[model samples]
Target: MLRDLAGAEWPRRAGLAALAAALGAENIRWVGGAVRDGLLGVAAHDVDCATTLRPEDVIAACKRAGLRTAPTGIEHGTVTVILKDGPVEVTTLRRDVATDGRRATIAFASDWSEDAARRDFTINALYAHPETLAIADYFGGLDDLREGRVRFIGDARQRIAEDHLRILRYYRFQTRFGAALDEAAETACADLAHTLKGLSRERIAAELLALLALPDPHPTIARMRERGVLGVILPEACPAQVAALARLIAAESAQGFAPDPIRRLAALLPPSPDVAETVAARLRLSKAQRTRLVNAAERTAHDSANAKALAYRLTPPLAIDRLLLEGADARGLDRWAVPQFPLKGGAIVARGVTAGPSVARLLQAVEARWVGEGFPQGERIEALLAEELAKRPQP
Candidate 1:
């Protein structure tokens, strides 16, 4: 049995206290990730609360308390209360009325245990009171949390049948917190891996990126492959690419770079821009994300000799991606800011070159020479320009 939330700082926020006072502190308790992470001693980023009060009543209470509230998910029994510090989600305790693996129809309930029962995982169903800071573990969530286990509540397959996204969530949680995979949950996820096809590509992409964003996702990713879940959503990422991902991770660590999900995703795919664009389209990635993915997929030698020139051509980030993918040193660009081309087309025209297509052609030639010569400036740029112009026929 978990005791009070001692080291948790979220319960002491003024906005939470004010809202609690307005809605009778006993009527509300911090629930879900906030409660789970608090007990784990991790700083909770978002605070979620469950209340006996209905959505409308919660909105009314917030308005009366002078706190702004938004109907973020009113149909599903949630209201966003904007506090001074940040927004805290306040939701009425709910029970699943119906579920179709994609979404659920929920009904308001006053029983905390009933609400906890409807949740997906035991660790996520834990709650903590506001006033006394007492934890309510309707399931063995406290024991599971202490054991670093992520088990689904009740029937694993049935819970997954309620929401197919849980399959990915299980892997993410397992990667983040679990010491060992729950055998039943793993089996259920493997069996229901095909159901992930029914989920929206956007949702699947979000979950996949979140999983890839973890510091060390190699083990979980291998487990996902073993369970046949990775192939369902990301068929482009072949088994051989798992080794590529491991190499990329090692390179990132060596370069003191943070874990980049998009770059990692690029590493998992073949070095073909066409394949990258196709996968990006299938996953519904944003335009910028798609471009980055394609850029990283381009088959190019990221030689250390031309590191600056590469950064100059394709921005530093893209250049770094290619360098890291090829296992080349990219630290030369750590503090180096790409310099602007010292001469423009106007400068070429000023040198008595015609202002038509010839001027543009001459500028390109000079810039190429400048880039090849390591972006020389001052007299060197003037010398390059004079040399290029001397080659051109006098007007």
Candidate 2:
């Protein structure tokens, strides 16, 4: 299946330009999702090339072309060629020599069929020649991709057993393709769900985050729960809460916020202390994102007495918190964060004629005085500051 690149023209140019220089007589072919997506008439961005060249040869070729090449995964026969516009990942054909489920020892091979067979799923095994506009489907991946079926390439159990992380990936693929999985594939995943303990929390978190970040997460998680995957990964997600969160998420999915990772994660959190931190640590999220997400969850769980306390509880997302309060029977966002502290630390320092802790105390006194006065004019603040400043020691 070939057509002139029309809509997303830049990425098409990037792929073509990179392949033109790198694939120059090397017989390298575009492989994996890039090809599958192209075949499905979907615009693809991350273009990967399967090459006949060995890792060393790819390195040498890039050097010969004066291209910057990094050993992205040298042991796994992958090198990222840094081109002027786009980076193309050139990976030699490889098949697993032995797999311990967590890691595998692979050997580079020239047999495209052998390499394709060792891949995880049928749809991911398809390859295409960008220049000639030809496709190579050794395992009937074309048919499977077209049918929206996510089936393992050869043996389902054997494939997943090669890497336990694939167990989570199956549901992610289900979310993307919405493909009806084969019976044998479902059985294989269900059987291996218990073996997920062998996988590291870091790996589990990555796959789970990707699944939750999908446009529609409920179907994917529901599949995982049904297939016994979620129990092993996230049992704290109350079944009813999970469904409600998903429903709220889908309804709010259209607007109100960017697709920020922390926002998405806040929507997923259960009413439990340390769970957010544990999951965030497990996923290896950046310190900022983790803290923000934890704060969001904690704020959502709180029953603050007043507007100020509630506003303090929810640092940001004033609008979203308002909606959440309505949904959760809490004080409205306005009533919660209604009052404003007009005095600044600098103003307090200036008024007190002293720095350090005294400035803080003076500001606090000013705030209290302002609130006590029910928020008066500049005359009231000036009068209050004058009274508080007299109590501070002159510096």
Q: lDDT of candidate 1?
A: 0.89
Instruction: List, in order, the clash count of every candidate structure.
Output: 0, 1
Q: Given candidate 2, what's the lDDT at residue 249?
A: 64
CA RMSD, predictions in order: 1.9, 5.0
Whole-model alpha-carbon lDDT for candidate 2? 0.70
Candidate with the greatest TM-score versus the true structure:
1
Per-residue lDDT for 1-395 in model 2, tens only? 43332333333565456555765734687788777777667778777888888888888877776778889998899988877667778888998999999999998898989889888888888776666657788888777777788888888899888998888888888778746768898888889998888988878877877876777777666667777777887776656656755655644554333334455555566744488788777668788767665765555433433434445435435435434522443323433444566677877655435678767767777776675555676677788888877776665
TM for every model, in the order presented, reads 0.96, 0.80
Candidate 2 Cα deviation (angstroms), residue 382? 6.3
lDDT by residue (1-395, candidate 1, tens digit) is 33347777787788888888888888998899988887888888899989999988998888888889999999999999998978989999999999999999998998999999999899999888788888899989899998989999999999999999999999999899898779999999999999999999999999999999999898888778877999999887787888889988899999898899999999889999999999999999999999999998994773556888888988888888888888877776767899999888888878677789998888889899999999988999999988988887665
lDDT of each: 0.89, 0.70
- The regions of model 2 sitting more than 4 angstroms off are 1-11, 14-19, 259-261, 264-268, 300-314, 317-342, 345-362, 365-395
